[model samples]
Target: MTAPLLSVSEISKRYGAVVALEGVSLNVGAGEFFALLGPSGCGKTTLMRCIAGFETPDSGKLTLKSADLSGVPPHRRPVNMMFQSYALFPHLNVYENVAFGLRRKGEREEAIRARVSELLDMTQLAPFGARRINELSGGQRQRVALARALAPRPALLLLDEPLGALDRKLREETQFQLKEIQRKTRTSFVIVTHDQDEALAIADRIAVMRTGKVEQIAAPIEIYEKPATRFVAGFVGEMNFIEGEIARDDGAAFVTSFARLPRAECALPQGARATLGLRPERIEVSRDGEGVAGRVEDFVFRGEYTLLRVRVAPDVVLRVGAYDGRFAIGDDVKLTIAPDAGVLFAESE
Candidate 1:
């Protein structure tokens, strides 16, 4: 947000007839953990490659620390990339693998040793530096790759789904560890991920991309509570959408069939086509309540909570949460939308 650590200006890329990146532009601040989040084939990978100098853009400029990156090769740029596969050398021990880059840069052996030891200790790989890559668990191997990338202390570190290979439990734990290391090192990080939970849990800010363009760039809470587009609302979390036209009249706000929606959360023109976007937890389900009528159609037993699907209209089956087992399928119920809970988006967005 300050003078950016990295600046990407109107970058575009293509392959034959297909466009991989189209005028994508963003800025990464110093010591910020920024995330580029989207589904597969969304051009996040392409953008990362461009920053790493692995892929050149068809047009645009990239600058880091006020220095132009045009025509700069990957090795010459003050940036490092950690691949998803944890590209550790099988023949080298952990210490040697981490010290490889430093040695390549012609640092003295004593300085390389001290730096490698510090990094190994930081990543909790100090105890296993003498072991070969094959002898370590997946989590340990990941830490090794992370340490190797951080050894040189580059101004920017690019992580291409660095935890993709770890199991879910380990990945969750490592997320916090990664953040701690980034904090201690104070190095700017730009991570590429398709997992929404990962981005929300780890990033200082997120840029949600779709088909080569950034849809929204904001902190995790804003991206969830005030989505810039419908695609962002659907991609970030579990959301229910209902379409309607805005009406300022206190008398009639309906098309005669759907449940009455709350006042729009945003400013919209009178009679403009709009939509109500509410998260599942925003709706309260009860057997006898002063609200819209519906029936329990199905249920999903999620640990620590239960999810109920209530069909309130012919085509609208709103998913609401039910903590107790008081209701069953085919039971009549009332659905109440919490006051000041839903967000309104232009129907065309």
Candidate 2:
């Protein structure tokens, strides 16, 4: 493995009594698109700020190419941050905004013009160089913001919820565009976002945070398929959680027994409490079959997919997918899950 472009080691931060981040560590390879994903107030932004030199951590170390960034100022560090709001100067034209960093560095007028022109072409905004910030659409403004951040040729780029300001349709379109731009530039990108789909779609690796801790760090597919904890299993996507006690654990398989469960699927350990996690999409529902009997409580049609809330045990209601089935609200259905499709999690104390 080559040396990481950026590495954060055991970083911790606190705001008086509230702990913002604790012992968070991550490594990003050169040119990799890494995402810090979590809900609001989950310390994703704080982590990004720390890397950008805007917020200093209380402990631990931040390194860029093996060099400490503790005392480095934001402008002096070989990093540039693209803010969520685009942060475009209202009074400056597109070219001037992209050229702002060059002006600060005291580059000659002719050199600034050439560098800005190249960036404009790189971002496909060459024709809009003369347009004012307010004149560009949301997607165009996003591109301008990206161009401005990339103009300085920073070794690493930090993005704070880069697509949060765009509407749904535009956000989806710009996600791919941003990935392409990152690949073209070959710059390491650390993006902070709360949208799971966005992280899964754009990032080479994702660090899922909760409260002030990283729950899991893995590729999108691995994180979605083999979540390490109950929090991760529940947070990453839709899941059916069935609670029971472990009847057996033989390393490979664990059986959990519930009152209504016909047989122990896989036991964990004798007397251990456990929960089975099955993704909604991985579950198969049939009109008539020998499986878990459940009554359809309600469902919503979502054009490309359907969501069904099925009442299984009296205490548990499972959310399942109905990709093509048209079972009515009051119909009974049998839900069958492939043994390998579910993961068993030990119940949290």
lDDT (CA) per prediction: 0.90, 0.87
* Model 2 RMSD vs true structure: 2.5
Clashing pairs in 2: 248-267, 254-266, 254-267, 255-266, 255-267
Over 1-349, each residue of candidate 2 has an lDDT whose tens digit, in order, gives 6888899999999999999999999899999999999988889999999999989999999999989998999888999999999999989999999999989989899999999998888788999999999999989999999999998889999999889989998899998999999999899999999999999999999999998889999999999998988888888888888887654333334343323333335545566777878898887888896877889999988787788999887788888898876889999999877657778787872
- Which stretches of candidate 2 lie above 4 Å from their native place? 108-110, 249-267
Q: What TM-score, to 2 decimals, does candidate 1 have?
A: 0.96
Q: What is the C-alpha RMSD of each candidate to the true structure, in Å?
A: 1.7, 2.5
Instruction: Name the runs in model 1 displaced over 4 angstroms.
Output: 251-256, 264-266, 324-326
- Model 1: weakest 10-residue lDDT segment is 251-260
Error of 1 at 236 (Å): 0.6
